[model samples]
Target: MPPVSQAPNPTPLYPWGVPPSPPEKSRVGLMAGIIGGVFLLIVALLATLVLVGKKIDSSYPPAESTLTAPGTLLDGHYKLAKDDSPTLGPSLEKSWRLSWDAKAVHGVVVAYHPSGGDRGELIVTGMYGRFRNTGEVRSRVLAGNGSRHTEVKVIVAPMDVTPSGSRIRVSCEEVTRSWADGKALSYPVCAWADGNTWARVAYMTVYTARSLDLESAARITLQIRSEMVKPIK
Candidate 1:
């Protein structure tokens, strides 16, 4: 008796002409796609950085400027005097100034009571970057060779407020002193920084007085800070 032969398995075939994809090749393709996506993301980030840099350059005002003349003040009560001659530091360079490399600006403004006689004084300086040791720095400047009255440092109120949605900080210094005529004097100086701008204002007596109007001095300083935040036209 002969045994029946087992039938051989037939080759598999699909209705359409299709080829099987290699698993390794598929994996390599997926990896390539991921790398491409990452490269695109990096390029987008770099473009965003360039845009931000442009915005800052266009929006921020020039840190270096001559003193806001007494007449330019919003109140319009103060005016520069011919003989007073407020000192303006070196003229601003034509080149662009960045916040990190910008230098400080120094200038002066003098005023009179309009009715008669001297009406106190206002001085200003602006700069880029943060301010520190303000009290000490101002103290040294006040004790200049020309200051007739000895400036005695006193208490100052703490202020932390931003003007025009800008970063700002304020400080005050009160001192008692005597004039050439031996009249008791009150000097309250207020200082503040708006972003890269730093300014100081002091209430001086045209005539001998007992106490300085600190509130007025502080008010003026805050006003200056607000202006500093605005872009130059």
Candidate 2:
């Protein structure tokens, strides 16, 4: 009889299924966790970038070698000829041109110069014994400023012949660097092949007064290859 007093509809406990609100502390803790995770991810990414940058900076060609010795000038004319011999190596089978401009600069010793005619778009240089068939050979060809730097360096026995039969290995470290004036920039590509045989070539402006863009340098390099010369003997 007491309960019969209109049970008040049992107050419908929690308004039929509405879940209770989460605690403020719990919500704050979840937000903090998300923020902390994001912060850690950013820190990790930054650390990786720093490490990669350091590696690249250290790997660039060293500049000290450039300022040491003044390179010898090779301001002479040359001629080209055709080479169809099978034993001359693929590099020489193209057109072969030869010039004698023995010079020394920046510790780089030059042996031969090729103004390419049919040798492909490349210039091959023979370095000193540093590139002799034994130690190491560093050689390079610069097409121009901002152009691709092609270098050939190797370490081998004292009398071994290089892949191109150009030079032997001694000790070599080849590199290509850039220089600029107000109008245009120049790239000097240098390499050391065998002893007493080094090579250096630059794709520079035909006329120093004019701008020597990258395209021009590339074209010049191609011309040198097309007119490359080799020793027939």
lDDT tens digits, residues 120-165, model 2? 2223342221112213223222222123333321212112222333
lDDT of each: 0.48, 0.33
After superposition, candidate 2 runs with Cα above 4 Å error: 1-28, 59-61, 67-233
**Quick one: best TM-score, which candidate?**
1
Per-residue C-alpha lDDT of model 1 across residues 1-233, encoded as one tens digit per residue:
79999889876686566877765657788899999999999999999999998875555444533334344443554444432333433322112133232334343333433334645554443333333344443343333312443444344433332234433445556665555686655566666644344445555555423444555555556776554444444
Q: Give the TM-score of candidate 2.
A: 0.26
TM-score of 1: 0.44
TM-score of each: 0.44, 0.26
Error of 1 at 55 (Å): 19
Q: Evaluate residue 186 in candidate 2 and report its C-alpha lDDT on the 0 to 100 scale.
A: 29
Which parts of model 1 are misplaced by more than 4 Å? 1-67, 70-74, 82-119, 123-167, 206-216, 226-230
